[model samples]
Target: MRTSKTFSIQFWMDTKKSKKSEGLIYARINVDQKRLSISLKRKLAIKQWDSKNQKHLGASQTAKEFNRYLDLSKSKLFRCYQELRDNGEEVTSKAIKNLFLNEESNGYTLHELINYHSIKIENTHAIGSIRNFKVTEGYIARFLKKKRIDDISLSKLNFEFLCDFENFLNAYYPKGHPKAMSHNTVTKHIQRLRKIVTLAYNLEWIKDDPFRRWKSTFDKVDREFLSDSELARLATHHFKIDRLDRVRDLFVFSSYTGIAFVDIRNLTNQNVWIGDDNGNKWITTTRQKTNCKVKIPLLFRAEKILNKYDGHPVTEISETLLPKITNEKANLYLKEIAAEVGIQKNLTFHMARHTFATTVALSNGMPIETVSKILGHTKITTTQIYARVMDHKIKSDMDAVQKRLNEKARKFEEESELKNLREKIVEAEKTKYANLTKEQLIEKLNEVLNEKSDTN
Candidate 1:
């Protein structure tokens, strides 16, 4: 059971932040004699305000619009009060105001929602990913400051608010960044924002999604992968420095095995196993990103890398099969490796995984289903992203079709020649018989048939 509480609302003028002749309107909500004031963000000229009636003084167009807005606001507030009571929530000035302001009973603010979203995902999400959410938190805080508000309730968030935030992100250029955000970068930030807001909706903290009308899209990016020649060049290049040598081996290992840097960083000797049937060595682990199982047969190239670093001092210290290196430092060293080897692409650790997907596996006639499983993809469609980018795969598939068509083309030409010969003989026979009488033609045809039958 819930206690019933008295509730009422009254409109008033707040001129503190307004010009001398105009005053900002606010709705003062009263529950049990306690009061909460909500700024309507609407203003009216002081001279035209009617305090007793709580409306504009005149019937002119602007006055009529202002008065109409006040009327609707009053009716909406009353309805909100009734609904809160009907829902059995404590009827208080803040609760009523929160409800009328577009908040559910939970009454979450923007910053509060950000905090909740952070804590909710902190355990499950990676540190880098959580840092990104913090970046968004800074943006929202700055946006509120730009709008001259300390914070905003999720109820107060609207389509216009989101569009403004997106525009703010589009124009923002932090120091050290060469330019403003790109389409995909902006989309990424916006995507994180949407995810946070969606969490609110999913938790039933908000009745609606402010981003319902807002759409976010990203441009198609060409995922860079190593070609066969490039892979060979990088794999075979030896560096004098032991550090560079180890980094190169790591990158080449990923190229052969399609494992990510983070996953590789955690790999130990225990991850290896001998196959039951074929007795091949295999690396079996779960992808850190998706927590999906990854079981890839260790190719000889990958095995050679493992053997090279087997029981190395670094590996012994880390208790891993390969020497441990920070992903960042390893990639930085790879740039030098690229310059030394004369390969002309922006090389990164992840590109090695892409190379394995296309150049090392898919291009070598490995099945896509098998590739998806090896990559620990929950769905085959996720693997197809790599497939679509392989233009040579597209051409190679068509080459087989083109070969079959070439074979049939010659046979078709021979049949066409025979058809021409038959038509020519028919024309020649017509001409030959045209000069002969009908009886003579019949006698010649019968004589030809009799000779052919007797020979048979």
Candidate 2:
């Protein structure tokens, strides 16, 4: 069986300083082949040493932290190799490096893999996932600089390391930013890292998948949709009366259609079909996201918008149904419209997709499964968020039911009043019978009973 080599990065405090004395500095680097690892050691500030206080002034008390760092790198590497060897694979430092350096693994070093795998999803896997992966990559690099793609080891990836990175992200991120990553963001990076590491293992690059049991830390996001009041406000919002207006209208159109921006950009006159086959005029098209064809009974408003924009001049001479607007400009216009409508939420191209899912589709009592297909979500869970927003519809139905019950009660009260009046008239007639001595009490009682029954 093969074995991994052991190494350590040592830190030492320097006592001598040639300049104005500051706190002592320490430095570290790994060495294994009997060569001295060189680094500039931090100098202790003898001038600031407090004999009475028994502490070094102007020095960060990070001796324990520095020691932990040294232990972490060595221990993580050893544990990673042990995991591989336990899994019935020969393990050595060279073998580990060779596995990590394989070009098929995206030329990631061991350190890169450890750090990269710490994140759940990576941008390299797909085009749409790039934005998030780029953010994750930047965060890791900012905290841990210049990590070679091949130097990652398991010991470097314990729970503490993951937590520390998350803390670092939260602390360093600027205040009041909506897109600032959460714990779940950290988890996604880790998950992606795990997936890539698993690939490496299958390729015999590493002996074991250390992240196989790792879990994520993000709570479910409350997917919000526009309320009726918000939608009404949006409809009346006056967008900038220019090309930006065109972009806004297209975005609104997509919200109603539940088409993603990518799909909308690719749309053309050919994609729209009027089906007389169903004995009614319906706009039929397939969503590019899910490749699912949908036939929506055309609303007059939707049809009007479509016709107004039909065959609009495209300067680019492309077959796109709408004039091409860059995503950045579109987003800017959306934010402007959102502000005009008093929507405090940050508006994006993707928000239009969510608006369609909740406002245009699910709130109208559409089945979630159908909505999912319309939105082209790969999972039912993706569609489930709309179900949560449908709570208001359930409340509306309950209110309608209560209104009906109240109306029924009012009608019953009116009938009861008439019955009481008829009873009183029969009693008056009986009282008059005593004076006349001809009208019978039995006839009065029968009249009253008949009147009450008729009223009922």
Listed in order, each prediction's TM-score against the native is: 0.73, 0.56
**Residue-by-residue lDDT tens digits, candidate 2, 1-456:** 544365433444445544665545332333245323222233445565444433344436564454455455445444544565678676644543433333223344555554545353442244455555556566666666533342445434445656666667666654577566666666777665555557557644544455655566668787666766776576556765766567767766777777777777776676666567765445457664455676655555455557667766762377666767888888888777777668888878787778877877778878888888767677889677655555678899899999999999999998999999999998987677766433566777789899999999
**Model 2 segments beyond 4 Å from truth?**
1-108, 111-126, 146-150, 154-161, 174-180, 202-204, 236-240, 278-298, 390-392, 400-456
Among these predicted structures, which one has the highest TM-score?
1
Write down the lDDT of every candidate, Cα atoms only.
0.86, 0.61
**Residue 317 lDDT in model 2?**
79
Worst 10 residues of 1 by lDDT: 98-107
lDDT of 1: 0.86
